[model samples]
Target: MFKKPTTVNRMSQPEDFKNAFVVGTANVQSDGKLKWKIVAIFPNAGSLRQHGNILVVAGPGGGKGRIITVNLISWGHSAIVIDLKGETYTKTANARYKVDNGKGKVVVLDSKNGTGHRYNPLSVVSRDQWFDLAAELISVTNGDPFWSSVANDLWLAAWSAAQHARRPHMPYAVELMKLDLSDAICYFMYYHKDDPATMQHLLDFLGTRPNEEQMAKIKGGNASRLLESMWKTVKTTMTIFNDTILLNLMSGHDVDVEGMFYNGGITTIYVIVDETKPRVFAAFGRLIMKTLGDALIREGDKQNVVRRPILMLFDEFGRVRLNDVFDWLDTLRSRDIVLCIFLQKLSQFAPKNGKEFDESDENSFHHWILFAPNNPSGRIGKLISGMSGQTTVRADGGVGRSVNMDGDITTSRNVSFARRAVVEQEDYETWGADQAYVTLRQLRTEKYVVTSANTDNLGWALPPEAQPLPRLSSYVSPLMPLPSEIDAATWTAAQQIVEEAGGDDAVSNAMRAALGGLGMAVTV
Candidate 1:
């Protein structure tokens, strides 16, 4: 055998040199891939940067709650989750401490009906916020003249009550009363009845009180009966009045709790209702969300500083009326409020009466999370595919014949060919051509992935039982040790040395030397 060239013993190999090579100035590669090496890879840092929000979408039994809980522990952030389905999150490890936070404060708003949880708009929000929320609710009813009238009357009555009670924001009440009937009529007329003519007539009637002849003509019109019925319903419902006691009860507090809004604390007020009987639940949930959004916007303007971030976590978001949510999402982020909506499917957001879907609305959320879908070909699938940036591939071919000649005599032989080989010909031949071959296969199975930054850390690796417990909450406590304690201690020691010097120049110099010897510092 040829003798191998004499090799010198060396401290390192060529691979090691390859690992250390730099691609650009100041861009050294310590790992196999340059980009990965530069990227910060903290194994368990849970906090995400503040530029964007996150969304976590998973199917039932997909471990969404476990993921959220774990991330909350890791990130040292607060959350307001609207827990539907009565699934208590207590089973997760160290859940009690996470809930309590050692401040003798843990707020859980149970929105379930019969649990005595009901939200009243007047309590949690200011007068202007309440007005905006009411506007949204009325808008949802599509500006039904009857609904408009009812809203107008109720709002006017609420204002009077507030004024009578000497509430601070009484001007908002007077303003409601001052809102021209024409404007209210137009708003309700367009949305609820879906008729421009009806709106025009209502506006005209408001401007110049219609005579019996004009009224008779309006009554004979195509939408007259609908308008009549709408008015009756509105008038009846608007008669209901709100007093201080009702307002107190709706906010889940006595007068003292209302002051908490002005104070700084996480206040979770639930508007619980029975999901099985959806009518009441839907109405209440919509009202509450609208009210909260309005309040945050108003407060941001008044305070001039975005000091806190309000998190509105809507579980079972599909059941609530979502008209104003798109608008809220577009604007709320700048106001330091984030809305986290959890929905089962995209189909649940579809328009009810053959209306066009407007995905391009500015208020629409920039992020979405898709979970394992039950129906891969339905609207939900299409919505997911649209949001996910997926693509399609197609292949076409057919079987053919081949011949071979051997020896002196030419012989005709038949061989098979595939239109689209299930396996590449080379791969099939590697396994031996004698074995049966398959061709033209397509894969279609729904899976899950994190789709948004706000929800990037949610969901399960396997099922809940198989997932490793999240270990974030054990690291620090807001109510206990401050994260800057060590730095503070170092500063304190330096201050003590300065104080000990007692303005003596010689002693100060000697003290500096002593501190330097002890690996410390004394600043003059």
Candidate 2:
């Protein structure tokens, strides 16, 4: 209903923020005082920094989206950005933040070209987190009910076994996926013998004998069908792990979430997904969001407070539905974890998930910058309008008529007033190419014309001059210890046997074969 503010106002950098980090100009009054309209993240004032989480709904080519990215980087906030196009953050934001006087660094993990740091989703967290990780993986289902439950149970069993094994590094995806049902059952039977209750649960689930009879029954009876069904459901979930490049990134503990956000260090994790492999990248994206969110919460609890506020700037955030996204948004602020989700449409978040965004999800965000929707009546616009409330406006004007009688003319007038929403549904139908609507926790909603930051103030351009992430180039290399390396005590006998062998090839094969005997046919 009203035009966006136009009088430009300049603001000085805050002490906490990096030097020369200008978000945008505000308006100054004739009395030599300045008035701001929610421009900079942590403005010269102190209160703005308290509420860090923000949500941006923008479409392609809207400069506002880039503005948000630039300001966050300029402020030197530690962030993990999931950029689909490999442009903004890697080229601009990364360079800008690196030059900052703060203790922040940018590391890009390109999944397509294998150029950045190595981050093994499975290996990144501790043993205590494996259960949650498995739950995240299974949460992305394909709408099949029976198979989904079977796969969930199978993944739980395999994940539990991996944690119990307590190897030097986390077990590989192939190791977990190739685990035979019979073997998982036996491993649990022997390892959990002291815990009769757990053993009983496994025995009841597998529906087979405890010892030698188990493998035979698993290979032939109704248990065989169940195992096959479970594997069928899990095979698709294993696609990302089966990939050589993806496995390498996920095989080592290269990117540590807690350490990155621990001491005000700005660690940038760029998850580059290949367009050719949508499903693979999709799964990895979901895994990263879920795992990182969980880690931040745990780390915060351990330290009682987060040293630096961590921001997760996910572009096309709708690409993956984070299993516990709602829970995270509701509680992560206690740990100083801020979420800035960028999406083209609101429906994308719950697309095909049969899940609806609840009031809790809506209330969790501190701010929302809703760009002009592609269509006025589109679902996103309606949803946003519903939250922002309706507006009433005059729809018609007054009419006047004159009548003549005996000697004089009598004048009469009739006035009419109609009401309509301040922001008409039609406004969204034909959204101006460059218009956007911003909402704050306090103000609720206000319109703004998108603007870009001063390019001169920003740092370097495309191809930032940053060092490669420090991680072993390849886990499959023969010179390196096998991915399954465990404690020195457990490997003592095996280490001696391998030392006696003339070459590593035979020992590696023997070790792999030994794992196969235990029912995890890991293809090293």
User: Per-model C-alpha lDDT, please?
Assistant: 0.36, 0.47
Each candidate structure's TM-score, on Cα atoms with residue i matched to residue i, is: 0.47, 0.61
- Candidate that would win on lDDT: 2
Highest TM-score against the true fold, candidate? 2
lDDT tens per residue, model 1, 1-524:
00122122111122221222111101113453211001001111121112223344455644355444333333222344555653422322223223335221223333342232334455656544554555544432343353554455445443434433344222233232333332333223223233333333333322222234334444454332333433444343322222222222243332223222344443433333456646545645665566656666666556544244445556667667676666666466665555666665554553433344434331244333334334535553444334311111100111121222111111112112111123234432332221221110100011122221222333322234423322111111111111211234444544343344233443344334433444323233
Q: Which stretches of candidate 1 lie over 4 Å from their true place?
A: 1-51, 67-75, 88-101, 111-119, 138-147, 166-232, 235-248, 251-263, 266-271, 302-306, 350-363, 374-376, 384-524
Alpha carbon RMSD to native, model 1: 27.6
Model 2 pairs whose backbones collide: 9-26, 120-250, 376-428, 376-429, 391-422
Distance from true location, Cα of 152 in model 2, Å? 3.6
lDDT of 2 by residue, 398-446 (tens): 0121111112111111211111112222332232101112212111221
